[model samples]
Target: MKIGLVCPYSLGTPGGVQNHVRDLAEALLARGHQVSVLAPVDDNEAPPYVVSAGHAVGVPYNGSVARVTFGPRTAARVRSWLADGAFDVVHVHEPMTPSASIIALWAGDGPFVATFHTWQVRSRAMSAAAGLLRPALEKLDARIAVSENARSMMVQHIGGEAVVIPNGLYTKRFAGRIRPDWQGSDGTISFLGRMDEPRKGLGVLLSAVPRLVAERPGLKVLVAGTGQADDVRRSLPSSCRDNVLFLGEIDDAARADMLTGSDVYVAPHLGGESFGIVLLEAMAAGAPVLASDLAAFRQVLDGGRLGELFEPGNATALADQALRLLGSIDERDKLRATGLSAVLRYDWDALIDEILAVYDLVAR
Candidate 1:
């Protein structure tokens, strides 16, 4: 079977949707199914079937960018790709985006599926556009969401329930590809995601770092991912500033190094995460994680038994958890072991089989 993936984000974005597509594409290829990606090209050398989706434009509702629409040009390319029967199913990732969704809506006659990946948090105005796009989503042979929370939100707004197809991780993709600049040492707490705004709890991580460092003095924090990294870098207090290393937007390899080297992965995320794909990635890399106790995060963290859970946006609790992990070796190992084992529940093979089952059900 040949599969076509249409994602609004690029390969280099390092977000859940893009990473999901990357893993799913390769997983499909490994199964002898031809997979193609339609997205922005960040790196010149990409998977064989990828077509450039142009640079992204920032969406008003979400911090992330939606791919630029080339009007009929994009439509033509999409139609040509779909019309060729080169794909048995067209899997559209993040179908609400204006540009990418339009391309998917206008594409071809094959069985098409849309995976909704966002909360649509920007504003009320974007709903008009979202409303305009509902038919296309309705037209999908099947629809999916990364988490139950995501599926509920999509149903409430779009008037339909999409099957919950959790994202999968390609655990060994970064084997032996540690970052050159990464120097793994004792007592390092890591934050790996977009470093913008207070929502992601970068501020909480920054606030917690100083308190943790003051207690242990050996505690260092590694902040990974790209957006607004400068804000995080600048806001770091003088004492703990040097101790906090900023790894601005990394590839799979760098994320692997950070996860493998760090004592604990911290994501105090307050909003916009449905499944928290990064949490699973960290777990797969054998890093103990400290995350918010949101329902979606709980699903990813295995109901908090697999890792430390704290209130979202709480700096003090976050600090306490960080300090605890920094000092303990046995608990850290336990969290790591538990996390890796838990991720086996969401492996690509199992996930794809479930997804295919949905396709069969929906397409019928």
Candidate 2:
């Protein structure tokens, strides 16, 4: 089968949707299917199968800055790509965003399937654009949502239902050898996301740091992502500043190694999380997970049975849970064992068949 996948976000940037599209294309190619991905890219060189739609510009969206591409030039490019590829099925991710995915929906004339990956309580942009978006959306042969939250967004804003299909991960890639240097020594907590973004909740984690350091003087916090390290460091109390290490931005291998060495992986996100792919990655890397009690996080953690959860944005609660997990070896081990078992269901091998079934249904 020949497949074409469209990603609204820039491939050069690290994002959930971009990673999903890349991994899905690779999984399909490995299964003897022809796959091509169309996305906006920045300076980084993309994989051979990726067709660059052009550069992207950042726009404020969903509590963060989203880099996306649109306009007449991009639309023309999408039409050309669609015509030249002659794909059996085209899958567009986050089609509601004003990016390449929505442009592909409007320009292409073939079997179209869209996957919604965002979950917001309300979207004024979507509400205002409903009439304009509906005509193009009607061309879709099928619609998929990455989670129940995302499905609800579609029903509320677009007045349609979508089949729920959770995001896929390359579990084996993260389950590889651990780097000794990246491993935590005394007591270590790992966090990965945009440090500058408030939704990523670096501030909440910083607020809890003083308590954690007081309890275990040797506690080390490994902060990895794009942000001003100095700004983050200054936010913490001077006494606890030495306990935190900010790793500006790390690649995938380093991320896995960091998780492997961590005593606990903490995701204290405030909101705007549709699905927690990082949680799955941490679990696959044999790290015990502790996160906020968002609905999406709860589903990913299996109601806290696979991992641990605390009240969102509560510094005291986060600190208490972190200390509890850090102090109890048996608890962390139990979480590691359970998480490893549960994460397999989200592996690409388990999910590819379902995605292909959707494509086959649409292409027929």
Candidate 3:
């Protein structure tokens, strides 16, 4: 089937939704389906469009603070695609913000299948926009959520039963050789995500790092993502500077390599992490996992059966857990073994097939 993916967020960029759309598009294409992604191009990747800036936490990146922009010209491009009706189905990810997907809702003349990936937590403007968009989303033939948290949010707003279809990863990307640069001092753990949101808990993670390294002198941290790296840089003590490396906005391949090389992966997101896609990538990369104490994360981790667990924001607790985790080489290997086993269920082919199944049911 020809699928037109409509996401307003800037892709070709470093982000969860962008990666999800790109991976799914690639997977669907491999399966002999025609797929086109409609998102503003933010980074130096294939497709070129607007640079939808992002939100700022405590520091500014580049020359600007952070904002996502979609002007009239991009809308013209999207409208042209919609009018062409070149797709058999329309796939919309993140049904809120940037206005492109909202416009597509009206412009596209095909069966629509959408996935809501976030829980309902946002600015009043975003929330209000979502309230307006929910009715239109309900009109879509197929609706799926990446997590149960997302499902409840969709139900609360859209008044429809939404299937839970978790986001997927290309297992091969994470299974490859470790990158040379990613190798840390003695033993290193890493965290990957946008650090601007308090939900990411970079603060919580940083707070834990000093404590962990205090006990385990060899412990190092590598943070790779597209947020305000400065805040983290400033907050980290002078002693921990050498141990913490900040790589701003890496592509999927480099991220996978980093994951493969790391001894452990940490995602101490305190709140608003509806689905931890990074955890899947880490697991796919054969790294043992550590993450937030959220139900969604637990569900993603299969109840700590696949990875280690820690308190959300308590640095001391996280540090103790990280140290305890590092000491358990056998335990980490077992967790890695378990993660590798469970990651099979998240293959892109299977996930795309399941999404198509949802479309079939919805269209019926």
Better of 1 and 2 by lDDT: 2
Model 2 Cα lDDT, one tens digit per residue, 147-239: 999898888888878898899898888865655555446688999999889999888898999889888988889999998999778878899
Candidate 1 local lDDT, 61-115, one digit each (tens): 4654443454666677677666664677788877766666557765556578888
Best by TM-score: 2
Clashing pairs in 2: none
Clashes of each: 1, 0, 2
lDDT of 3 by residue, 28-82 (tens): 7787876677766544544432222222122232222322335566567767876
Each candidate's lDDT (Cα)? 0.74, 0.90, 0.73
> Higher-TM-score candidate among 2 and 3?
2
TM-score, cand. 3 vs. native: 0.87
TM-score of each: 0.89, 0.97, 0.87
* Global CA lDDT computed for model 2: 0.90
